[model samples]
Target: MIICGTNAGSPRCWMLVNDTVLTDVQGNGQIASASDISPPYPSQKSISLPSDGSLYSAMSSVTGHPGSIRRTFGSQKLLKTENVWLLNPQFAGAAIMPSTLKYKEEIYFFFSELNKTARVDEEPYRARIGRICTVDEGGIKALLADSWTTFMKARVMCGAGNTQQQYNNMKQAVVLTAQDKRAGVLYGLFSNAWGRTVICAYSIEDIDQAFSTSKLKGYSSPFVGSRPGMCVRKNSTTGGHNDIKNLGVIRYHPEIEDVIRPVGVAPLDLPTDDQITHAVADIVLAVNDEHYSVLYLGT
Candidate 1:
């Protein structure tokens, strides 16, 4: 039961190797072609870790490797492109970047826009997260026909006013990959063009609301005074990219937006002049008969 996880900062491909022929998958021995199927991909692209048979992978783009999702049975195989999910035009948050977590049967990628160019006068980067239900069956002809139908994103208000200028770049993120669902929290590292990073914790519930709720309409004009990416469900029969594009124009979620998030910047003692860099989070389960977990943060 060898499962291989290969990704180049983004995208993934999973393949299972048979028990009898572990010898067939070679390394520096220089076997020109083990078979027609195995040689097309460079061995370097593979992270070489066994898989759990789940469609999840993460890596840094600097590797410059390609990825795919393949399910193999003996000598037969099928390319499960339908299992793939991604964002279009990319979302902002080039400052912080994206992270992944599995909630229920779905997988989530927590990231923001690629480059937070101000659509409005001084608007900055906005934090965002998207999800793909492992169970999504895709669609028919023009629309849901691909493996990426359920993909969607929305704005996140972690810092001050939850506005653009407040937390422009979502610099780094740490997700609780092994905590209890209800007891889990997402710590997003955010910053601005001015060079400051703020880490905010979003509860499992609030994070779910941001992705599950319906989105607001698009902004016709910035002067409309409407904050984009409001998480409200709508009843329109519109199609694809508009669905995610609407995430940018969400009206607002008063109670859930700015008010319910972490109130202040993470209380770190970094020098005021230097911008913060990276973060890692751990969920420590309580000792004794406690029914909860505590997030231990180390700088």
Candidate 2:
């Protein structure tokens, strides 16, 4: 289902379902009815079924705390459901992008790490985007594996032109290209300090693999542009130069040296001789349809 107006609530979340009206059950919950209700929304309400039976509403809570899943389901009657913490709490301050696809029975989460160290000049802390994978199973087994598996410990950092500084304080978003179904590539959009310029990076492996082998050879270059965000479409009936079209939004600075106007996505195989540029916004991928989606918590 399309979830609209998620960023428009008082707390900025979508409230209506299929155009049906819903009443807030409590401060953190909502209830739906066949008809309308008066003020002081019900904390618990029953939903009518086709057979004239009733189904109770399932509530989800999001505290926006570290290691918290923004969405969950809990029984109103039993109160026995447990909350799922997908990431380690140590990475609590990190900006969570969102969730993407689940492959090989693993669910991937993308996020950006903000550099919190104090500086004499007081520059804004920079961010680096990465991905982590956890088991899809919901049980002690999954939680244990997520918490302790060494294989899960692998991570990839965005690189800047063979220098760490290129991606320093980088803000990025990742998405899977539908063009290469056999070996989908993860595309990243990032920016340096001042957000005046942006860069693009790509990896053959999924987010998890990209994070593991970021330092290895064959990674894409840190292409420069204004600010950029990725637009990815899989299986486009609309024909294009490539089976997949990786589009980006970018703005250019006229005064900066080596700064190019209007950026574009060249074929992945094309020579790097001034064919590409950077992006403007964070690229977002669908969690279920794509391999992964990464969310950012801070600006």
Best prediction by lDDT: 1
Off by over 4 Å in 2: 1-18, 23-107, 116-135, 138-160, 172-174, 179-182, 206-299
Superposed on all Cα atoms, the candidates' RMSDs to the truth, in angstroms, are 10.3, 17.9
Q: List, residue by residue over 133-193, the lDDT tens digit for candidate 2.
A: 2222111221221121212212333443334344333333344444323243444444445
Per model, state how many residue pairs clash.
19, 25
lDDT of 1 by residue, 1-299 (tens): 43332233232323335544432333322111112113223442221111224223222112232232222223211112221222121222211112243223444455544333566555344455654444333333443333333444455666555444466456565666433343356667767666656667766566565554444323233323222222123211144455433332331221122223553533333345445576666544566755453433344
Cα lDDT of all candidates, in order? 0.39, 0.27
Residue ranges of candidate 1 with Cα displaced over 4 Å: 1-52, 57-104, 115-124, 162-165, 177-183, 219-275, 285-299
User: What's the lDDT for candidate 2?
Assistant: 0.27
Best by TM-score: 1
Q: What TM-score would every model get versus the actual structure?
A: 0.51, 0.37
